[model samples]
Target: MSSHEKHDVETSSGHDIAPATSTASNGLALKPTALERERAEQLARLPDPDAGKSPEERAEIDRKLMWKVDLWLIPWLSLLYLLSFLDRTNIGNARLAGMENDLHMFGTDYNLSLTIFFISYALFEPLTNTLLKRLTPRIFFTGIIVAWGIIMTLMGLCHNFAGLLAARFFLGIAEAGLFPGVNYYLSCWYKGSELGARSAIFFSAAALAGSFGGLLAAAISKMDKIGGVAGWQWIFIIEGLATVFVGLFCWWMVFDWPETARFLSEDDKIRLQRRIIQDRQGHAATDFDKKYIYEALKDWKTYGYMVIYMGCLCPLYAFSLFLPTIIAAIGYSGTTAQLLTVPPYAVAALATVTVGFIADRTRWRGYCNIAVVLVGIVGFSMLLGSGDPHVQYAGTFLGAFGIYPTISNSLSWASNNIEGSLKRAVAIGMIVGWGNLNGVVSSNIYISTQKPRYLTGHGVVLAYQVLFLLGGTIFMHFALKAENKKRLSGARDNMNDGLTDEQKLVRGDNRPDFIYTT
Candidate 1:
């Protein structure tokens, strides 16, 4: 017998067969690899975990289990982010409600306050996410919320520009974990395909917070000098206290990880564990390891994701922080401008959720982002093109509607494409943290002197949206497509399939079977 034939026949009954030189000819179209054949046979022989149960019985169990998890998880998680974003963006609302007047802030004091928050926020994110890995989610997440809530309350008491800066800086430190932490946590529970929609649900709360903050500020501004406090003070105190209350309640409500969830039955837990493993195609890396962080840092894709994220965030954060101010500059001021901020955010909240659902369903994250960015480009163009305030206001609607969805889409895309817990954690932290540094650039762009038209600010944002952002998105899309093609056409088995479970966790996205989700 030929040596190759002898090698294959000798190992035909086992897994470690010699590699095939080419397909066995019998006119077949595709030749199965030894690993693929072995896997298929093993699956055929193994009993299903739910083998004895009827299809109806299994379906009913799955329905109840999913409903329980969904109900207990999404609402409170969304609420946590809602509060986090409210505390972050309410400063914009407070500015018009006499915060600047009461603190004697002028020129760039307001800009400095906004810029300083993002600096501390960006600096602390990676460390905070790493801490979430070491500490239990329950302890760490609730603690940060309480801490930031306290800082939010203290903002009400800041009597000077320095005091306000101090409050904002600490608030950033406290809030550093939330965005990345939540993204990591969701990946642990949901399939990669599910992340886009789930992230949308989480992010939509931030948009809603902007709307709520606007309406709340308009109402609270009327409470000026109520008791011994200014309306701006009331905004911080009321919102902060509400956040603290919710944070305390989350201690009881939040689920840490599926394996640790007390509410799920043993069968449901096993099923969920199996489903998550299958969803990742055995590539999900759950173990805590420093190597994963190194892998993320070394990967060129990490920086690519970061650049795209920064492009999106520059405009998103700037718009969120300055929408009220921008509206006021467009000839509406006081309560009317605050009220005007409401509809754009409301529209954005809905548009973001819808796009998220579609992105998840279609698995078209890059395309969706490009589409939204295009919409934002149009919005910015209209804002720059128009001499009319009403037209500029309409442009705000398009900008909010577009950019908010892009943030959720891009975020979910990163979470979906990355594998390994630590790698994902590091990637998310770097992308969000570094991306937010653009907020410093954005904060300074809308100079007080250029108010009303702010031609320079609009032009700069337009350039970023059209140039750097569009370029990053297109490059990533093609890069991921090329990588997927290589993997699909290659003959190798999953690189870590022969390794021990512990080694498999370490291998992460390096596995040959793993395909990048674009």
Candidate 2:
């Protein structure tokens, strides 16, 4: 194969994407020719209606394309995430449905169990993501989902503390790669401008799962007479079956990577794929090196990012895993509690979509992060301040809405700031890994004493929101400062120096140039 042909992926019509070439002797790839580099850059910077793919004249074309892509991506993803999240979170619903009594968990044992899952999940996330380079993300991804799905179903069968812990630990292991892998894959398909909204659209599945889980539990609790199985058991069996089925289906549906997708036509592949690398102002990085990961760690921005993301697990877990219990305290039965839980997630899903679209249109991410966090604080504080069911329930919307930015902003920020090819790969992994470390802390916040009113739980969650908002500010501040630093550093210094972004893969991170979009 010619140099460019080596990188080529084919479309359905057997059309080939433009080939990329590398000059490096090392395993790392160097950028292609200057002209090829330029083409990649142009593609990246193309204004949305990006490249007029869906021009004003072709509204139907746009709709059809969106549907075609979403058809495969959305259902499978929604099902995948719904299952994982529902299983992880059903503990909350199950808690209210009588898990605490049957399991003999008291004080904070349940909360501790929830927190433990994240510990294993956070610790292994980076390791699993790096594995993607070697693993067929499709196979690798599906394997984990299927394993976890079975584990979730088995949670219903647990008779004691040990059994529950064993299930959660394996559940953590199987579900580890999911969030980061999908985030990385999405980055491959969509440009920075289009990603935020699409990301939200994808993530909203979790919220929907949250909504439906409540309803499922409500109905299941009514089936309390089935073989003496608790309502929580039904929650597990149903969601787990759905997860396993959807996971099997996802392998057939999801695009493995841009280069490997089965759907796009060759011309569309050529046109679509070529656009990203070229969009870089100039230069590309090639080489798969440990150094990229190191530099990202060295970069203080990683620390700043950790703030918003790291502290997130508490609020999210508290909301997802403990929500049913929390809502149940508002003086409702399991069914009504489940039904009420739906609104918060339903509202959250809507906000996720709306904010993503607006953020995409404006090309502003930090502002959106800040705005969402602020609204979330309102929701969290309401829970802290009131005991009235009406008031506390209303706060759920704000809380759910606040989290819309977790995926949208985090991944978008990484895509904007990360420059080199290997660096982009590694940086995104760390972003997810380090940030999720907070899940451990987030999980343990809900204890038995905190229940009914959960004064401590509410306080801790509110405090987490406060921390995340501060983290958001720091992220924007550092992002702006980095851009300023780059500006003062003066013009970039190589043939690849002025290369297009797509060409970046060839640049082998020698600290190749990148602009941090504030």
Candidate 3:
């Protein structure tokens, strides 16, 4: 028998099977290309990896697979994020526990420390995200988490302002990868609609940590003088140790790609991969190309998302990092102010998850974003208009509810609208990295000298809400609608008329088959 003929042999089941290469309609030999051959082999190896499965069966399989993915992945990522958030914002709690006097932070030193952390965070975030895919999610994420955890623990050892500043700067570098990396990783698994709620659940851990951190601080503050440590030191020591432990645990738990998930059957893995490809409509679904990075950089929507995200995060971070201080400034003092921070964060967590659920189900992300920002506008107006502590406290609740929802919405919105994995990676990273520069703005806006009302801070945040409402909500909604219309009108058919399949794949979102989601 010829080598090709031998390759076509079948089993005793009597099914007729052709060799890998066959004849085309014009009688030329039709051999599989490298990409096609790899895809075919991947499908063939997966147990029962057929699209002919019944809808009911497919649904059942997908449901089980999603549950498994969620179970294995979500808890660990959320826990790590919870700790990341706790460590990040715990400086406020530490301040309440006497870190300011211990380290002799004066004037704008505290503000500068916060500003420096964000500067390092913003500078490193995109670089870390670009490295994440290359390093693999499991190693990159766990390594950064461990690094930050160690930095956080060592914060307790810092006896001077310079020591705290250095620790915070490095901590920012270590933490830059996590939040965006998790978002990029989720885009690998979930569809556009599924992303919002999942992102919310993941992001909500920050608020939960804030509330939990308050209670933890209250308890830990009483531990002053144990092992020659101050109460603030204990707060960092205990929380940082907990974060390190979670990071170590997650090292073995995180799955970088769906196909590599050990908990999944071969058939389940194939289906998981197929579902995301279908969801994204073949826009950079499975491969990485350097051109996608350049394309994303040139895309205007990337920066638009970044600006809107900045608007949202400015208020969110200000609120998270200074709620205790804000409360203390409003006449509450000692642990009472620390305890008061819990409610706003708790309320914010509830608001965040609820809106995320609604946005996913309704698919009204653009409108949802606008509506939430308006709620914050009202909150900020109230804060600016009132002098009553009770009224100000109510405004805090409103502001918390408004800002927290936007984190998930804006994240999922960017992830939803951008196509192609590498493009999305750069886009998400840029959005997050650039947006967080607002942290520097936020850190400075609430100056100690401007306390009691901080009219400038409230006014600045309110103006941002209006800007996002106009640019991010109204403009993006109409722009996406116009683009989708242009694509549907078949106006770009001439551009790809002579292109091969491989060339078309290279077009990414510019492909006629691609439609931008609003």
Go through the candidates in order and give the C-alpha RMSD of each one to the true structure. 7.7, 6.9, 7.4
The global C-alpha lDDT for each of the candidates, from Candidate 1 onward, is 0.78, 0.68, 0.79
Clash pairs detected, candidate 1: none
Number of clashes found in candidate 1 = 0
Count clashes in each candidate, considering only residues at least 3 apart in sequence or on different chains: 0, 28, 0
lDDT of 3 at 238: 91
> Candidate 3, which segments miss by more than 4 Å at Cα?
1-53, 283-288, 492-503
| Model 1 spans > 4 angstroms off | 1-49, 54-60, 283-288, 491-507
How do all the candidates rank in terms of TM-score, highest first?
3, 1, 2
The digit string of per-residue lDDT tens for model 3 on 476-499 reads 878877887888898765667787
Ranking by lDDT: 3, 1, 2
For model 1, state the Cα shift of residue 10 in Å.
Answer: 35
lDDT of 2 by residue, 203-315 (tens): 88888889888888888777775997877777777777777777776677765665566786544454445544434433343345665566666766666666666555567
Candidate 1 local lDDT, 1-518, one digit each (tens):
22111111100000122232234458554665433453344335333568789989988877777788778788888899989999998999998888998999999888999999989988998787768766768888889999998888888988899999999999999998998888777766666676778789888998999998899889988888989899999999889999888888878877667757888877676666544444433333334557777888987878998989888888888899989888988888889989999999999999999999998888788898898889899989988888798889999999887688988888777776666656777787888888888888888788888878888788888888887678899999999888878777874455555687556555556666567767
Q: Cα deviation in Å at residue 231, candidate 2? A: 2.2
Judged by TM-score, which candidate is best?
A: 3
